[model samples]
Target chain A: MDLVFFKIALALYLGASAGYLVFLLISSESRASVGFWCAVMGFVAHTLSIMHRAIFSGFFPLATSFDALSAFAWLLVGIFLLVRYHDPSPIFGSIVTPMASVLMIFGWTLVYQVTEPLIPVLRSTWLPVHVTLALAGNGVFAFMAIGGLMYLFQERLIKTKRLGRLHRLLPSLATLDTINRHGLPFGFFLLTLGIITGAFWASSVWGSYWTWDPKETWTLITWFVYAGMIHQRMVLGWRGKRAAVLAIIGFGLVMFSFVGVNALLGGHHAFQGANRFMPPSGL
Target chain B: MEIMVIGLNHSTAPVEIRERITFPGDHDGAVARMIGDVEGVEEAIVLSTCNRAEIVVTTKDVEESRERLIRTIGEIHGQDPSVFRSYLYVRHGADAVRHVFRVAASLDSMVLGEPQILGQVKEGYRRATKARTTGPILNRLMHRAFFTAKRVRTETGVGSAAVSVAYVAVELARKILGELRDKSILLVGAGEMAELAARHLNNQVDRPIVVVNRTYENACILAEELQGLPIRMEQLEQRLVQTDVVITSTGSCDPIIGKAMMKRVMRARRHCPIFLIDIAIPRDVEPDANEIDGVYLYNIDDLQAVVAENIGERRKEALSGERIVSEETEKFMHWTKTLDAAPTIVALKEKLEHIRATELARLNGKFADLDPAQREALESVTRQIINKIAHDPIVFLKRTGAHGKQNLYLDAVQRIFRLNGAADNQNEGEEL
Candidate 1:
């Protein structure tokens, strides 16, 4: 039933992505509304799916890679909807829905039965709190990266004076810069809290306060990147294109920490244990 | 009645000729009323702008009205008819309607997609309304013209882009800064184009403008005229820190603001974005300054290039606007066709006949006990009454149609009888 709801959410998100893609081309208000409502519906179904998974698993459902990715996408969409409610610009939707849809697709492809009981190490109260904070922080950083990309696009168009249609369609550079300015410190703050909580959970479970695990090291690296960006932005007033580029680079670090660390380096948080639920030698 | 537009615009007349026949201020209404009093003209609206002078009217005889209108306009302005007659262009009927729509949409403007013409036309229509010179036909036509103009404005990018260098600078500022309400603007030196751009920016932002020049006295003079503060050129780098937009048009031999100085200024400004518009021939700001992180330097040529590109975009958008105007003109003409006596008279008869047949059929049961002769007499008497009731209106419509006053009577009959149904209601709303 959780899988069914997840698939429905995925389909709705795909529909929203398609709608937003069309909106980017023609820029019709009705098309944006279609995309917005699709995203709203997708968000609803995704919430139900997440709730169903939590109730069935008897814990917060971030044990598997699929659960973690789906939650990340859900948080991103939620943040997007909240921002859209205030700004009401469809341009962000054109960037956001496709990203969320891709995340949903990645999660859907890795879907597997969660018949095995929760792992001994994962069954802890701090599991939900740490993962939720980290994923929420990632979601915010993703939005900042989107804003950065838009800023560079708008800035280039302005600098080159080839304003064509997209220049008129996108938000101004200042607005995009503001997005980065506000998102940086908040995302960095959340990541800091997430790392601290993970340390506390690790101390309680593994009898150690710190570990040189690959995920831990990568998270620290990503945290340091955002930390530097925030310092530059606030102290030196590094903004506009420079700030946008740093934001994108910082999010790149975040992606590597969130996915690459666990996939490539066999860390303590690696999904190899969760992949045992997969059927052996089957399609 | 036939609608006609007789006008001389920039294309057909020189400024001298246009100036000679312009009816300024209070003279517009008087001129319109005078034209309304002409022998064949039933309604009149005189639109006199700097670029064009036109008389829009409804009349019985197009040729007689046009000839008398030309002579009367010349007489009002104390110019000979022969002096300006060759410059005037006339359009009648559907062509006249299309011309009004095109003018309102700014497609027929000297600068394509210029916005002032619509407001000018609206003011002319308002004056004609105040003078009580415009009747139902002209009123409806003016309203439809305003609607077409609005559709063209919202549906196309015809007037969205800036065409002048000064306005393009303002537009680019808005694009980069998002809002200019609090952004400070600096004037580096005194020049006509620089002052024009500054004044344009001054209207949008609330911040007081600052003027700096090599000659402090000139800066003070220009600043006083623009209602701003004057500063010495020695403080150029200091002022650059606080300025969000700078318009420099100095007659300097070399760059006034160099990349090195601009880089220091950017550091002092904490890398906040700044726009520099150099309208000078030799360029007051170094071209390399544009490479700075937050500096957007647009020289005179660059601004001109942007203006050229925008004008081209507007022209392309004007094609779509023209399509809207022609489509609306066709729709308006179709509605006018419904006002013709032939259709209204036929529709009136059909409506009355249908009513009579329905009433007679509804009372058929009551007359069933009577003989066939009684029923036949009932039907004939009802038909006769319907004909008698419809006779006066049908004749009135026909007579007015011949005399070129058919629109008023036909519209009245159509409304009182609701003959045109849903389409008529929709058109009535559109005219309003």
Candidate 2:
């Protein structure tokens, strides 16, 4: 039943994403609303599917690498729905729906689907808190990155003397900049709390507050990059192309920390036994 | 009743004829009352905006109403009916309803998608209602026109783009800077073009507007008119840092603002975005200033190009608006056609009842020897027979009428029953 819901949710998200892309091409107000409702329905089903996994598995769906990816995608969709509920602009969905869908596909195809029992160190209440905060922070950063990317696209067209379709489809540059400006600090705050919770959980379980594991190291790097971007913006008035470029770079590091660090480098955080799930047939 | 419009718009009449035919705005209600009192006119409204003069009415005869309307317009303007005959355009029934909807939606406006026409039409409806010259048909038509206008506005982007150079500058500034409520504006000269741009900004930008000119006295006058501060031309460098948008339309032969000077200002302002509109003929700002990273400089031609592009887009959106108007018009026409069946149905029932009553009275004389219960039964049976006979024709009239074939069906039913006079006065109290 959980798998059925997951599959249905994936299909909805894909359809909604395609609808939003078509909306960008057509640029109709009614079509935008239609695409928006499709995304909202998909997000709702996706949430239920995640809840289904948690209820049946007897743990929060944040332990295995596959669970982590699914949880991250769920958080991304949740944030998007929240943003769109307030903003109601289809441009945000045009970027976020695809991102969440891609993450979901990766989780479904590459990782083991079976819900693993919580390993001893992962059984604490702090574990859920740490994972949820970290995933939420990643979701916020992804949203900010989308805003940054849009700002760059709009700015480039304006610079190139081409005020055409894309220029009209996208939101104003000020609105996109405001999103990045607010999302940066908010994401940083969540990441800070998540890091603190991880430290506390680590001390209680692993007998150390700091681990320097590959995942841990890359997460720190991602945090620093975003923190630096925020600092430059607030202190030195970094904006427009410079701020957008830095945000994209920061989001790149965030993606690496969330996905690449776990898949490529061995880490204690990889609780689903990554190599065992790897297909025997090489690419 | 029939709904009709006889009018002359920008396309049909020259300005001189339009002015002569237009009703005075203050006396619009009086004119509507006068038109309503005309023979065959049941309800009337006179919409006489600067660009068009139209008299819309619910009437008993389309051809008679058109003649009366044309003569009334000519009399009010003290001209002969022949002078206004060539410019007059007349439409009745569904075509008239569509015309009203199109006018309200701004699809039939002189400038397609202009916003003021909807408000002007509403004002006309208001005057008619105030004068007690609008009945159910005109009231319903005006309400539907409003709804269609709202639908077109939301479903299409017809009125969303700016179509003038000054308005384009404002739109572009809003796009770049989001809200201009907190952004200060600097007018580079007291020229007419610069003052026009400043006037456009007055309603939008709430911050102080600073006007500068070579002659300080002219600057002061323009500044006072704009409710802004007047500064000397030497203060241009100082104002550039403080202002977010600068509109330059000076009459100087050379470029007033140079690249090197803008580069210095960008550095001082920490590279914050600044919008520059050079609407001057020869261009007030140097073209090289456009190359600066933080400066957005649009010349007169560039602003005109954007306006032209936006106008083209609005025209495209107007096509969709036209579709919405047509769809709504069809629905309204169906409703009115269904309404047309009511009087015919009444007339048919009255004719059938008269025949049944006459036949029953004749039978009563022979049945008087029967008991009271038997007489009652006979009367009830005869009434049922009459109802059964009238039911099929009534249903057919209403059904066919809703498809806009009511006139043909109604004519046949009336001729077969010889009930034309019976329904004429009854329908006068109802809608068409």
Candidate 3:
């Protein structure tokens, strides 16, 4: 996580995303190689960046909601890029890169604002541990979210009989279906542990175990939505479009839960218990 | 150099014939044994997949190698070597290189630049490696073939479109029906292409596939392979009524799917679209059946039109790929040549060193007035001068003699150096 490595990673991420888009238009395999190595370099950089942050400060770097989101976004993008690199089945930056670009933008613009949260809660030992786990869980969920959304998009094209160029680029329904099944459950398990830890930490600090806080409530809702998606897909022999649609909906809920709960809704955990990054109009 | 390709392609033989000639899975050991039995075959590998079975062998005697290969494989399948040889085509040197590149890139495949050929080549390389059948020559060749395939994909748009008929059928089905899993695929006349199309559907769709052919056993074979059910031709109408897609590649002389017959099936299905693929030479479905409502009819002409379009793209891309291959091939050859010349360059340097040592040893006493340290310094200077003199010849011999002339050049250089008279005697006596 040297500053040089971090800078190099950011450069690689930018290059890879651009390169993949170029290849998509030209339909060239040479750029795929460029795209793949760029991703590898970017992944190395992202990992180092996190490690640097961790070593510089005796904290997990997810001290605030913004820091948490950025790390989570990076984790999700890294995994997606690696999977596409190994599979080489045309699932590239089309889905994952845009998501990474947005998260990085948000990470840079917003996270720096909360550098001086003069509160004991922000300084608590449990804050880093709980938030780190939560963000990591969120990262896993986001991966599932993107994959599920792509699955949904592909299924829609197939259902409509359009058979566009995109259909040719995307993976088979069977592959998409399996990816969703494999990813979402792991995401759910992480989120459950994350929520439980958060509840315990809240009880210790705020003298309450069950608060109808926006973040907690939204997380609960996201959990239920995913739970329902998994149920439909596994038990009902539901596959492809119907299953993909549900995944998309669940991920949409997760997205809303992620930003809306922080930006608009008020809670003890909201904005990492700091008002500097929060706008004047508080939720 | 010998180059031989044994077994059948789509044009030279049918699926039944190719299947008979094709080896079982992971047969590199068997193939290697066969190649070992062939006189003068230095290396061999077998590329086996659904479309083709090709045996690539490298040897000094092309005619004998070809004969042995044909005889062995023919005997394996109880055929005369001459009969099988007539069905096989042999190419040597650059033609062999081009053929393998084309095959690995799917350009030489029946389906024309299909994606599966790359995977098949990988499997072939893997199996050959395991069996130790592939030596350095074919090892380099297969590896280059992969690069050629990659070059074809990157430099050309040949692989941009779905050229394979199986994929084309899937594309057409996707365009017409949308999400094949919800719709049933009724396969008639267990023709290889039709069965391949069905297999593609089976992987893509969730809907139960029903294959009804005239031969129940052929239908069963296709069904077992794809996890589909084999229904008798008697049940064709009943199944056709409910099915969304129908591919017919039967050997019927007259139309099995007559206009009146399809009309009743369409009515029974409540006007759902029924796709008919007439893959047979004389055509299986009637020409009039295409006129019916919600019926999409395509005979061999339509299939060929798609093939023509794919070929059009391939022809354009083939030129670009060939350019890339030409450049890459030269680059690889240059690398190999440089490596080959390295040993000669080393040996030539050693010979020069030996000459310099002998002359220095013989002449050292003439400069007796010099101190020991001064003599040592002179020795160092002589060695440096010898190195400077030897550099250009080493480069020349390495570059020019890298291929076939290196041995002759090295021998000539050794004679000029009197290397045999001095170095050989000195080395043997030094050891003693």
Candidate 4:
């Protein structure tokens, strides 16, 4: 029941993302209502599956890093769909939905390798709080990247005067810039909190507060890039175009470090009990 | 008081006059200061961008304020006030308010749906607020304009497609290369158009920008502004091999980077594609340079074709943007209309409350000696009468006044009971 609901939820999120992308290109008003409702349904399904898994296993469901990542992406999609209701610019999902899909897909790929026992190492009271915050931060940064890319693209199209068929559906560089402006601070705050809680968890386990691990370094770099982008935007009066591009680029860096580093690199941040990298018994 | 707007926008004024009077910053602080000094101007804001200079003011008499404002703005541009009198437009009452809302929402921008106007409006309001001249009335209108601007952006496709010629140049490069960060862009001349194309490259990636110009100083200046490095025109041959893109717009009679140099470039770069944009009129680079392998050259005519295609999309978004403005404006006007009646309604309600309470007090002592049951029943009957009396008149005032028929209805209610009696002491609720 748990796996079935999880698969259904994943399919819905991917479908919603594709639906929103189509709506962005053709931009019918009706498509927006469809995308928003689909995302909402997916979120409900995701939450149910996670709860069912937790109850069946008799723990808070922090057993595997991949499972936690999957849950977080689902949460991000839910939050993203809600925010999109308020500002349904196609560029938003252009940056956001990809992050949700990518994280879930990566986690799903490791389904066989990941281990999730409801033991003491994964049973800290702050486990849910820490994981939720980190994923929320990821969601926010993903938006910044999208807003930035749109800014750069919009600036170019305006200069070239070659705006084509789907061009009319894009958000204004100024509007994207504003979303980036507000989105950065929110993303920064969440990532900062996530880092702090992760540090607390680390101390309780690893007995060290600061380690220069790949995950730690990359997340910090992501933080600093956004921090710089926000400062350039607010205090310097960077306004629309420049600010937007910076946001998109910043989010790209975040994704590269998040999915690429975790899935490809066999660093300390990889799933603790990952068997995927191990050689096959016969081979 | 009437809402008054008088100034020249991109449609009415040229860039020279706009440049002179633009409140791009508190840059000169000239336009902002002059608007405040105009007589009968209670609250004011100045919105000046490359395309327009507009002054939105809350005033007692728009005609007088209009004349004064144009004169002051014209003076700032060192023109005789009468010369620009023909170009300046004057909108008053609801029209003036609607204009500001539309302009701030970017429905009136030169590009139709460009989004910078909202930030520009915010900057103007911020400056006015700093000067302490922008109070509640201007604040409310300005804030409503901002809300409308946001709605236009999200709910409508006001600024969707790339419209301007300069932006089109940059977008084309992206489509060809996938990403521009690591690519090399070479500017062939020292012209402003070349500099503009470079600015569009921006800080998307960590790649360096190279500018090769005939004049070292011009290249240096542009390079400094864009944080790029300058290379001399002598290196044109060598640079072409390394450069991925070349943009040329110059006044020179002959081609700067011709077919010979471009052919050499194609072979050296190993058939790596390059984009050549010629914006100059007499043709800076030769047209046949495109015949060479891996050279994707676009002249002004090709660009215009793309611009023509963009027009239909821009036009479509323009209609969508306009629809958004009309809907948002109606919603805002509804609020203002209701607000216009609220003060008098409050005063009328207060008068009724005072009379009802006094009559209740008089009856209170008279009924004190009666039985408790009898007093309670009488009080309930009196409360019901007060409700019935207040209901019909209040409902009548709200319904009639909101639909542009407030004058007679307001007078009738005021005369019947001499209610809102102090209305004569101040200006009537109708804005001039």
Candidate 5:
């Protein structure tokens, strides 16, 4: 049933992504409503799938890379759809739903689906809290980066003097900039909390609060990059292309922290028990 | 009655001729009265904007109304009617309704999509109303024009983009900065285009404008005129961090704001986005200055290109506006047809009832042998049979009437039904 729900969600996301693409091309406001409802339905099915996984596994579904990415994608969709509800702009879906779809596809293709027994490090009560906050932080950055990309696209169109259909379809530079500003501080704060909570959990389990493990180091680096972005925004009121660039860079760092450290630079965070370049294989 | 529009717009007449044909504000009601006094004209409205002078009217005779409108307009402007006749373009029936819709939608303005024409039309309607020259047909047409204008405004981006370079600058600033309510503008030197941009910003942005020029005295003079604070050119570096938008039109030999100086300002401002409009010949701000983070620099060519692109987009949107005009014209024409159909349907029913009453009265004595209930049943059965026979012709007349062949269809229905006096009554009601 969980897999069935997941499949349905994946299909819906794919359809919604195409709808948004059409909306972007033609700049049709009514088609945006179609895309929005598709996202909403996909989100509902995605939630049911995640809930089913957690219930059957007797834990949150952050045990494997596939589980982590799928859950993160779900959260990202939730955040995006909620924001769009408050502000009805389909332009975000043009970028975000595709990103969600890609993440889900990657989860299915590259990561193992089987739930493994928890290691001593992952068995503590603090595990769920640390992982949830950490994943939530990445989810926020994902949305912010999408908004940043739209800002860059719109700014380029304006700068190049091409006020065409796509240009009109985009949200105003101010609106995109506003989203970046609000997202930066909120994502930064959550990332800070995640880092702090992880440190506490690590100290309790490993007898040290600070570790130079590759995953921890990269996550910290991701946190600092976002911290810098927030500082530049709040103290300097810095925004526009610069802020957008920083956001995209920060999200790239987040990707590296989530995937690169596990796959390329194995550390205590590795789930398959060793650093391997090959995809994890299991039902 | 027929709807007609007879006038000369910017496309049809020279500026001198258009200016001569306008109704002065003091004599706003005079032109309506003059057009209303013409024979065959039932209602008249005179809309005299800077680019066009139009006389919209409803009349019994379309050709006669057009001639009288041209003659009266010529007489009022102290020109020969023949001199103006060549410049006038006339539209009647459905074309006239479409013309009014397009004009109200700003599709017919000298600058397409300019919003003032809608307001001008509404003012014309007001003047016509006050003059008591607008009857039911004109009133309904004007209301639909207003609704069509609103629909065009919302359904398309027809009147949304800025067409002028100065307005484009303001539009870009608002796009980048979101709102200018608390933002500040720095006017670096002064030029006509730069001043126009500043004025446009001042109207929408509730912020104090700062003027800086190489000559302190000139800066002070412009500052006083614009109700802004004046600063010397040397102080530009000191005040650069506070400015959100900088319009530089200085006659400088080289760049005034270099990339290095902009970098320092960005660092101080913590990278708040600043839009720089360089309307200068040699460029007051270095082109490389725009490459920095949070700095957007648009020169005159860039701004003009943006305006050009927006105009193209507006033209594309105007296609949709034209479709809306056609749709509304069809709808309004159908409504007028229904107006004609209403009285015809009434006349047809009355004619059928008249025959039924005369025949029933003649049969009353013949059916007197039956009881009262039986007699009533017979009467109702005969009545239903007559109604059934009349239904098909009545429906056909209404359907055809709504398509504007009502006179032909009504005449045929009356002659076939042998209804006397009803057709004449319908024609009289239509003329009124």
Candidate 6:
């Protein structure tokens, strides 16, 4: 049942993403409206799917890499819909829905079935709290990066004076800048809480508050990058292209810590016994 | 009645000729009433703008009305009929309907997708209505024209882009800054073009316009006029750091704001984006300053280029707008044809009813021996027979009317039924 809902959500998201892509080319209100309603329906199915997984698995769904990625995409779509409700601009939808679809595809294809019960350390109460906060923070960071990319795109077009179709399709530089400004501190705050919770979880499980494991180290590195961005933006007033560039860089570090550390360098945080489900051929 | 339009627009006449024929200050509805008084014209509307002077009317005789209308226009404007006769272009029937739709849609505008023409047409219609010069035909046609214009506006990108230089500057500013409500504008040296652009920006943004000039007295004068602060030329860099948009049109032999100065200002502002519009002939701001990050510089030529590009886009959109106009024109023409067929249909029904009544009267003596109920049954049966016989001809007339060649069908129906005498009497009662 969970798999069915997930497949439905993924298909709807792909349909919505295609609608947004067409909206970018044609710039029609009807296309944007179709994309928005599809996303709304997809989000409903995604919520139901996540709930189904949590209830059936007898644990919080974020115990595996697949669950974490799916939760990240769900949060991204939720935030996007909420923001779109306030702004009503389809340009952001064109950027966000495609990314959400890709994330859902990765979560679906790589791991379709729930593995055996969580390993002993992962069964603690901190499992859901730590992963939820961390994934939520990652979701907001992803949005900030999208805003940053759009800012740079619009800024470059304006600076170069090449007012083409994309130039007209993209939102204003200040709007994209404002998105980064609002996203940066909130994302940083969530990330800080995420790190604090993860530290507590680590201490409870591994008998230490801080571990120099590659995942932990890289997460700290990502945290610091965002912290620095927040400091520059709030204190020094680094905005526009500079802030956008840093936002993209910060999200890069985020993705690297979220995925790369676990895959490339196995540590205490890595799913050691779950290696069978890691490769696509395992399906 | 047939619809006709007799007018001289920017394309048909020189500005001098157009200026000579305008119907100015018709506060008492005198112009519309005068046009309505023309021979054979039943309803009339006079649309007089600087670019065009048009008289739209519904009349029985198109050629006679056209000639009389041209003469009336010359007489009203105090010119001989032969003086500007060659300048007038006349369209009648379906051609006239298409012209009105295109004009309302702004496809026939001096600037292809301009918005002012629609409002002007609405105002003209309102005046004609007040004068009681518009009947059902003119009222319906005007409403259809307004609807077509609205459809063209929303369904196409015809009137979406900014075409003027000042408006283009505002468009570019909004694209960059998102909103200008809190942003400040700086006008350097206070030239006419700079003031015009500043005024355009002032309408959108609620910010004080700072005027900076080489002479303090001149700066003070401009600031007072603009209701803003006046600053000396020495404080240009300080103001540049504070202002989000700077419009410079100074008469300087060399650059007033250079790349180095702009770099310092950008740093002082912590890299907040700024837009610089230089309309000066010799260029008040150095072109190299555009290379700096977050600094968007557009000169007069660049602004004109953007305007030209937007105009090109509107022209492309106008192609779709023309399609909409043609489609609506066809629909409106169909409706008018049905309107033309209405009288003939009514006359045919009346003709059949007359025959049914006369045949029943002739057989009344034969039915006198029957009871009241039997007599009523006989009358109902005869009426049903006549209606069944008339149905096919009535449908044929309406179908052929909407498909064009309405006059031929209408004439054939009238001649076969010998209903022309009845139709002429019905026409008088149909007039408003």
Candidate 4, residues B1-432: lDDT per residue as tens digits?
567888778888776666666544464444566687688787778877777777888776777877778777766667777666776788877787779888987888787778788888898888887776665567667877877777667656656556666687776776545467777877767566666766675544356677767788988887786677788888878888887767788788887778887787776775556778887778977777876644667877777778666766667766766776677667655544534456657767777778877988877867678897987887778777777887887888778754534544564555556654434412322221
- The i-RMS of candidate 1 is 2.0
Alpha carbon lDDT at A277, candidate 5: 45
| Candidate with best TM-score | 2
- Of models 1 and 2, which has the larger DockQ? 2
Q: Model 1: what TM-score? A: 0.83
Candidate order by TM-score, highest to lowest? 2, 1, 6, 5, 3, 4
For all predictions in the order shown, the interface RMSD in Å is 2.0, 1.9, 8.0, 12.5, 2.8, 1.7
Task: Give the TM-score (vs. native) of candidate 4.
Answer: 0.52
Q: Taking chain A of candidate 6, what TM-score results? A: 0.92
Report the lDDT tens digits of candidate 5 across residue range B230-326: 9988899889999999999999999999999999999888777789999999989999988887788999998887788788888998999999899
Q: Model 6 chain B — which ten-residue stretch has the worst lDDT?
A: B423-432
The alpha-carbon lDDT assigned to residue A167 of candidate 1 equals 84
Clashes of 2: 0
> Cα deviation of A272 in candidate 5 (Å)?
11
TM-score, cand. 5: 0.76
What TM-scores do the predictions have?
A: 0.83, 0.85, 0.59, 0.52, 0.76, 0.81
Q: What is the C-alpha RMSD of each candidate to the true structure, in Å?
A: 5.2, 7.8, 10.9, 13.2, 8.3, 8.4
How many clashing pairs does model 3 include? 3
Question: What lDDT score goes with residue A266 in model 6?
Answer: 63
User: What DockQ does every candidate get?
Assistant: 0.41, 0.43, 0.10, 0.06, 0.34, 0.46
lDDT of 2 by residue, B301-326 (tens): 88778778888988998998999999
Question: Which tens-of-lDDT digit does each residue in A127-149 have in candidate 4?
Answer: 67776777678777666666667
Question: Model 2, stretches more than 4 Å misplaced?
Answer: A271-283, B25-28, B342-432
What lDDT score belongs to each candidate, Candidate 1 first?
Answer: 0.85, 0.81, 0.68, 0.68, 0.81, 0.83
Query: What docking grade does candidate 3 earn?
Result: incorrect
User: Scoring model 3 with DockQ, what do you get?
Assistant: 0.10
How well is each residue in A1-283 modelled by candidate 3, as lDDT tens digits?
Answer: 2345556666777787777787777667677568767877787887887777666655556665555655766777767767765667655465566567667667666744433333455555656666666666666666666666776666565444344456667765556666677877787787777777777777776777667767678889988987887787666645555566676777777777767666677555566445545421111
